[model samples]
Target chain A: MRWRVIGLETHDAYINMALDEAISEGIRTGSSPPTIRFYNWEPGAVSIGYFQGIRDEVNLEVCRELGVDCIRRWTGGGAVYHDSGGELTYSVIAPAGVFPKNIIESYRLICGWIIRGLEILGIEAEFRPVNDILVKDKKISGSAQTRRGGILLQHGTLLYGLDLKTMFSVLNVSRQKITDKMIKSAEERVTCVLMHREAGREEVYEALLKAFTEDKDYGFGAWNRDELVRARELAEKKYKSEEWTFLR
Target chain B: MITHSSRKVKEGKIVKVEVDCEDVIKKLRITGDFFLHPEDVLDDIEKTMVGLKKDVSFETLVIKINDIVKNNDARMIGISPESIAEVLREALK
Candidate 1:
């Protein structure tokens, strides 16, 4: 089995989500090779889970006024905010037969890769089911997965930094449910790698690459021109559409 | 058994769904001004609820439906299960 990994720089949430969908679809339809991608979101955006209600999960008016784009993800999870300086996102696309058959098993198996990556960053992170990576009981990463057309796509984000206040403002945490104690409790439950380590983004990226490639025999490459063109088209035609962005 | 009503906006039009359900499953029929592709996606969602236990936490069922729609690339009229649950919650009130 061969692995293809690509490191992508900052892009908007729409573009990021579109690229992942395009790549996964491409692999499914035999238009592209199975791959892994690392990316960052620019201008910051709030993404709701597929099954979540926009009104219930996010403050849309606030997001509009603040110039933060809100869109729904193709995967199921709670709403999340992604920004350039806040987090690093990764997506892995593999043939279905390459991983475990059970959903939870697959999550654990792939989460092990994240654990290894964080270990390389000198932070001893552990996988916490059903979908989180934590250090000292504070969450450092969260992930979601989908399987289709004999292909598996697992994507996640690792916190490098966070803006909890803005996150709280944009997401629909009941004001009554968010006391000072609750805020402090949330802080205690979540953490960023930059808080504990003095590594730069590039260093962390390299660490993850090394970690993923260490035991497995794989090759690193870039997305071909055709795939890039297809991704851009998909971004323009579907993922970035108002219909899709605002769809609950 | 519980019956609930909720409103949703799809394609700039409002929709009202009336759901009758018990602790084990729900029977839903959506009505209002809206357009949906293939029309069967909604039916599929309703069918998925046939044997589901009402007490089983609607969140998990919604997630399951989301996964199915995403994988099948089904076109939804911008309605989400969360909206349905919200309507149900209000009905319970």
Candidate 2:
């Protein structure tokens, strides 16, 4: 079986999520090849899980004041903040049988790539159960998965340099609960690769690509013209719609 | 037994709700000054939720409550049945 690896530098959150969904749908429907893509979020955005309540998870007023976008993801997980300056996002879309049979095992296997990536950067990170990659007991990466139409899409963000204060401000962390000590504790708990010695964002991205696809043979492929059109339509009709983003 | 404190937002203000469920819902206290039409939607939601298994699917419960609210045209000030279901799901988890 041939695997296709393509890296995109998309900066818009809606476009990024739409492309992932499009690629996954394409692979499942036999319209596109299996793919892995890397991208970033422009401006900034907060993504909540499919079933999450936006009212409970995000401070909409703060986000509006700061000009950050808040959207909901199709996968299940806690809310996450993404910004151009802070994170590297990756998505893997493949047929269900392309990887291992067990779901949890598949998560571990995929997360192994992240672990290896961090290792190359001299940052010791471990894959936590279910779906998180942690370093020193704090999460550096969080992932979510969705399997539909015989295709599995697993995507996540790698924290390059998280803004803890802004994160707390945009998120619904209780103002009373988030004391200075609590903030310090959270800062100490969560870490980013940029905080480590010498490993910059570009370096981390390169390391991740190498870690995930170094041993596996990959071919270059482009989205067919039809796919590009359909993807854009989906982005306009679904990913960018208030109905989809505020479903919960 | 499940116990947790959840924040309820109404008009962008935060209010706290304390819940204690023992096997079934034993106590449902609404502490925040939020308004609900008919003044008993909370009790109705709680009653509908009472005796439900702790492991019951929260989504299903939310759906039921939503149906009830829609049928009665009840107003739930700052809290939605979905939000309540979310809190319950987190507690059970």
Every model's Cα RMSD, please? Answer: 8.4, 9.9
**What clash count goes with each model?**
1, 1
Error of 2 at A244 (Å): 1.2
Q: Which stretches of candidate 2 lie over 4 Å from their true place?
A: A174-184, B1-93
Clashing pairs in 1: B23-B54
| lDDT tens digits by residue: candidate 2, A126-181 | 98866779988778998877666678788998999979989978887544323522
Who wins the TM-score comparison? 1
Q: Which lDDT tens digits does candidate 1 get at residues A126-174?
A: 8876577988878898887766567888898888887988877787753
Docking class of 2: incorrect
Docking class of 1: incorrect
What are the lDDT scores of the predictions, listed in order?
0.70, 0.73
Q: How large is the interface RMSD of each prediction? A: 11.5, 12.8
lDDT of 1 by residue, B49-69 (tens): 566665656577668667667
For candidate 2 chain A, the 10 contiguous residues with the lowest summed lDDT are A173-182
